[model samples]
Target: MSDARRPNPSNEIMRRKWVRQLRDALLLPPALLYVIIEEIFWNGATALLRQIARTWPVRALQKQLMALPAPVILPLFLVPEILSHIGGFWAAYLVTRGEWAAAMVAGIVIKGSATLMVVWIYQSCERKLLSIRWFAVVHRQALRGRDWVLEKIRPGKELALRLLRRSRAGIIRRFAAIRQVLAARLGFRRRS
Candidate 1:
């Protein structure tokens, strides 16, 4: 048989090993990611609100945060992030083929990864706001300081965010309302 037609055992083994590695590299623990992402999003959001809080200087961040409910919270943690992993596998496949296809695949992977990264950051804010839990401390702490801390948190925003955590339904309703307002304000030319 021609060499091109012959199967190579070493190549097969290597591909298996690579595939395993890719699966393992999906993402790190949510809690750990939550901590790092939280700090960054909080600080950044604080700065953004400070710039735009002319209406309510003292607690603009708090208020804005509160107005945001959990349903909105769901997509922030979901879509882009989960798609990112899906994108990763697509990326791996891209590497073995056309250069443009690889680039497109890589873009998808990056977008997904970036979204997950944003989720990580938002999660940090969410943890501090809604108080996300860590698996490691499951035996000891259960969503600790979440409600208490938020109740005491500033800007009158906590009430809304607090309420979001209270009822998933409310969150969905509010998120729909907010999204509609946002779409109107932004004047969307296209829908995502």
Candidate 2:
């Protein structure tokens, strides 16, 4: 005989309490979705987001959502944002007992060091931290832009010309003397 039990037709039933539990359970997973979307949007989805936005569920869903004014739906994002602060608070609670409060107070610390660790965990554990390689790429582009700006603001060529005028002969003399010394040291005599 098969070990698998036959379906219970009676189990098709669901109550208001069950529906409430289902909705509540969904709230937690929305946070997970929030985390995933944020990571992709910031890091990975720049190329694919347009295609995604054009697709059936996202396009249709966004259409419905856009019908509601921004104010009405803005609170949807607030859930995870508040949870982030609450996460910091809980992590602070973990570090501090009654007597430890003095340490936090004496330093006049706005938040304990644990807050930074908590925020980092919030970023990485949620897989929202941008890859370090991508960050370096972005930083390199920013540096290039900055260098371009400095080039635009650079001193006139006349100033550079002035700086080179006296130094040019000195530079040439130094190089020629070094070459002559090397020629002498290497026993290479000039033909008369």
Per-candidate alpha-carbon RMSD to the true structure: 20.0, 29.2
- In order, the Cα lDDT scores of the candidates are 0.53, 0.47
Clashing pairs in 2: none
* lDDT tens digits by residue: candidate 1, 1-192: 999989899999999999876653542233333433444444544544434344454355546555666556545555655565565545545655766677575754464455545444354445443443442254135345333333334445566677767797977998889767865675532466
lDDT of 1: 0.53
Off by over 4 Å in 2: 1-41, 82-192
CA deviation > 4 Å runs, candidate 1: 1-66, 98-101, 108-124, 128-192
Tens-digit lDDT track for model 2 on 86-121?
A: 544543464476556554453223332223333333
Cα misplacement distance, residue 175 of candidate 1 (Å): 41
Candidate 1 global TM-score: 0.30
Give the range where candidate 2 is weakest over 10 consecutive residues by summed lDDT. Answer: 121-130
